[model samples]
Target chain A: MRSSVALWAASLLVYLFLYVPLAIVVAYSFNDSRLNAEWVGFTWHWYQVLLHDEDMLQAAANSLLIAFIASTCATVLGTMAGLAMHRYKPKLLPFMVITPVAMPEILLGVSLLLFFIQVLNLTLGMLSVILAHITFCIGFVAIVVKARLAGMDESIFEAARDLGATPWKTFKHVTFPLILPAVVAGFLMSFTLSLDDFVITFFTAGVGVSTLPLQIYSMIKIAVTPEVNAVSTVLMLITLTMIVLAARFAPETLKARS
Target chain B: MATPAFADLLKFRLHKNLTRWLVSGPPFLFLLLFFLAPSLIMVLASFRYPGEFGGLAPLRDANPAVLQGLTLETYRFFFSDVIYAEIFFKSFGMALATTLACLVMAYPLALLIARSPRKHRDLMVLLVILPFASNFLVRVYAWMIILGPQSAFAHAIGSALELFGITPVPLLFSPVAVLIGMIYVHLPFMILPLYTNLEKHDPVLLDAAQDLGANAWRRFWDVTFPLSLPGIFAGSALVFIPVLGMFAIPDILGGTRDMLIGNLIKEQFLGVRDWPFGATLSIMLTLMVLAWAGFSMWLARKWSHSHA
Candidate 1:
C-alpha cells in the first residue's frame, strides 16, 4: 500500500512537471501587462493584439500553405513507396527511407541549404522550404504506411488477382481502401511535422519568408511578451488538434493502449 | 470501342516489374535528389576553401595552383580552434546528462502507466503526448517564464532562502536552466517508448517470481529490467540525438552565454556567414550521432542476447 502511494505521487508530480509550463503559457497569454512578470488582472487584449498583427497572420498563412502542399505530396509518394516495399520487400528500401529521418535535423538543414545555394542555385523561399520538408516528411509517412500494410491481410490482394482483376485494378479495388486511413494519418502527421519544423526551415528559408515557428523564434529572440504568448497558445491548439485527429486515423500502435 | 482499346493497352503496359517501378521509383528518386544529394554536396563542399566574404569561394576564384582549390584548411582550423573543441565537448556532456536524467525520471512513470487500467492507460498516454503537440519554441518560452526572477515560484524560493541568510540563486541563463529545458522537452520521447516496452511485459513472470519466493527488487532486476533494455536504448537515442543538436533551448533559456555545437554550427552559417566551416561542423556532428546510435544498438543487442 505504501509503495503504491509512492508510485502514484511520483507519477503525478512528473505529469505536473510536464503540463505546468503549458498551463503557464495559456495563463500568461491573458496577462494584461506586456511584462510577463506578475499577473495584473486578466484581459484578452493579447489575443486581440495577435488577431490584428499582420506579420503573425502572414507567417501563419505561409506555414499552412507549406504544410498543405508538402504533406499532400509526401502522402502520395510515401503511400506508393510503402505499397511497393510491402509487395517487393526490397532490402535497400528501408535503409534509404530511414536515412533522412535518422540524420540530425541541423545536418539536414545545413546540407540542404548548401545544396540549394551552391549546387541547384535555387532561391531560398517557400518552394525550397516545402521541398526540404517533403524530404524528411516522406520518411515518416512511409514508416507509418508500411506498418499499416504489414498488418493487413495479404490474401485479399491475392483474392482480387484470382478474380481476373489486373494489378492496377486489384490495387484500386482492394488495397487503396484498406490503407486509406493510414494514408490520411500519415498525411496529418506530415502536416503537423512540417508546421512545427524550425531547424530546417530556419536554414532553408533564406530571406523574405517566415513560418510561424521562424517568426516565434525571432520574436522570442527580441523579447518575451504577452503577444508572443497569445500567438503560441493559438499555434499549440492547432498542432494539438491536428495530432489528435491524426491519432484517430492512425493504425494499431496509437490505438493499442485502449 | 476506343475506351476498351485504351483499357487493354493500359493492362498490357502494367506488368509486375513495371508496377513495382512505378510505385517506388518516384519516392526513391525524390529522396535521392533532395536527401542524398544534399548530404553529398555538403561533404564535397566541406573540402573546398572559403571565400573572403564567408561562404565558399567561387569555382573560378579557386587558384588552380594549389591542388585544384581543395584544401584541409577548414578542417585544420576546426581542430586547432579551442572554442570549437570546447563547445563540441560541452554539447556531448549535456546530451549525456539529459539522456541519463530522462532515463531516471521516465522509468517509474512508464511502469505505472503500463500497469494502469485500460481506460486510464490511454489517458496517460495522451498526457505524455500533449506537451509534444505544442510548438517547441513556445514550450521553451514557457520555461523562461517559470524560471525568470519575477515569477512567484522564484520569489517564494527567494523568501524561503532569505530566512536562512542564503542568497537566492538565479536559475535562468545558466547550464541548469538549459538542462531543465532539455529534460522537459524530451521527457515524452523517453516515456512513450518505455511505456510501449513495459506494456508488453508479461505479468505472469512477476507473479511466478513472487511465488518462487523472490523479492520485488530481485524480480525487477532479474526479470523486468532485462526485458526493457530495448526501450532504454530507443528512448535514449530519441532524446540524445536531438538534445545534442538542440540550439533553441540553450539559446533562449541559457541567454546565449554558453555555446553548444548546434549554436556553433548556426553561428558559422548565419552569424559568421562561413558556409564551409558550418558544413564541416555539420558533418562532424552527423558522424558523432551515427556512431552513438550504432554503439547504443550494438550494446542493446549484446545485452539482450546475453540475458536471453
Candidate 2:
C-alpha cells in the first residue's frame, strides 16, 4: 500500500511537471498587462490585439494554406505509395520512406534550401515552403497508411478479384473504402505536422515568408507579451482539435502507439 | 481456345504491373528528387569552397585555372577550432543528460499508466500526446514565462527560499534552464514508447514470479526490465537525436551563453552566411545521428536474441 501510494504520487508530480507550463500559457493569455512579470486583472484584450495584428494574421493564413495544399498532395502520393508497399512488398521502399523522418530536421531543411536555390533555382516563398513540407509530410503519411494497410485483411482483395472486378476496380471499390479512415487520419496528421513545423520552415523561409512559428519566434526574441501567449493558445487549440479529430477518424492509429 | 485464355491472363498480369508502377511512381520520384537529391547536393557542396560573399555558389563558377579550388579548409578549420569541438562535446553531453533524465521520469509514469485501468490508460496516453500536438515553440515559450525571474511562480519560490536564508538561483539564461526545457519538450517522446512497451507486459508473469517467492524488486528486475529494453532503446533514440539537434530551446531559454552544434549550424548558414561550412556541420551531425541509430538497432537486436 505504501509503495503504491508512492508510485501514484510520483506519477502525479510527473504529470504536473508536464502540464504546468501549458497552464501558464493559457492563463497568461488573458493577463491584462503587457509584461509577463506580474498578472494585472483579467481581460480579453490580447486576443483582440491578436486579431488586429496584420502580419501575425497573414503568417497564420500562409501556414494554413501551405499545410492544406502540402498535406493534400502528401496524402494522395503517400496513399499510393503505402498501397504499393502493402501489395508489392518493395525492397527499398521502407528505407526511402523512413529516412526523412529519422534525419534531423535542420539537415533536411538546409539540404532542401540548397537544392532549391542552387539546383532548382526556385525563389523562397509559399511554394518553396509547401514543397519542403510535402517532402517530409509524405514520409509520415506513408508510414501511417502503411501501418493501416498492414493490419487490413488481405483476403478482401482476393475476394474482390474472385468476383468479376479487375485490379483497378477492386482497389477502387474495396481497398480504398476500407483504408479511407487511415488515409484521412494520415492527412490530418500531415496537416498538423506541416502546421507546427518550424526548424525546416525557418531555414527554407528565406527572406519574405513567415509562418506563425517564425513570427512567434521573432516576437519572443524581443519580449514575451500577452499577445504572443494569445496567439500560442489559438495555435495550440487548433492543433489539439485536429489531432483529436484524426484520432476519432482512425482509432487504429492510437492503438499502434509507437 | 487455350491460347486465347493464356493470352488474356498474360494481358491481365501486364495490366497489374502497370497499375502498380503508376500507383507507386509519383512518391518514389518525389522522394528521390527532393529528399535524396538534396542530401547528395549537401554532401557535394560541403567539399567546395564558399562564394565571394559567404554562401556556396554553383560548381560551374569555379575557375579552371585554380588547381586547388576545391579544398578541405572548412573541415580543417572545424577540427583546428577548439570552440567547435567544445560545442560538439557540449551538445552530446546535454543530449545524454536529457535522455537519462527523461528515462528516470518516464519509467515510473509508464509503469503506473500501464498498470492503470483500461479507460484511464487510454486517457493518460491521450494527455501525453496532447501537449505534443501544440506548437513546439509556444510550449518552449511557456517555459520562458514560468521560469522568468519576474513571474509569480518564480517570485514565490524565491521568497520561500529567502525565508530559509537561501538565495534564489537564477534559472533563465543558464544551462540548467536549457536542460529543463529540453527535458520538458522530450518527456512525452520518452513516455509514449515506454508506455507502449509496458502496456503489453503480462501480469501473469509477475504473479508467477511472486508465487515462486521472488520479491517485487526481483520480479521487476528479472522480468519487467528485460521486457522493456526495446522501449528503452526506442525512447532513448527518440529523445537523444532531436535533443542533440535542438537549437530553439537553448536559443530562447539559455540565451547567448548556451551554444550547441545546432546553433553553430544555424549560425553558419543564417548568421554567418557560410553555406559550405554549414553543409559540413550538417553532414557531420547526420553521420553522428546515423551511427547512433545503427548502434542502438544492433544493441536491441543482440539483447533480444540473447534473452530469447
* CAPRI quality level assigned to candidate 2 from its DockQ score: medium
What's the lDDT for residue B103 in model 1? 92
Can you give the TM-score per candidate against the true fold? Answer: 0.94, 0.96
User: Chain B alone, TM-score of each model?
Assistant: 0.91, 0.93
Which parts of model 1 have CA positions greater than 4 angstroms off? A1-3, A251-258, B1-14, B60-68, B160-166
lDDT of 2 by residue, A172-196 (tens): 8998898899999989988999999
Clash tally, candidates in order:
0, 0
Categorize the docking of model 1. Answer: medium
Residue B208, model 1: Cα distance from true site in angstroms: 2.0
lDDT of each: 0.86, 0.88
TM-score of 1: 0.94
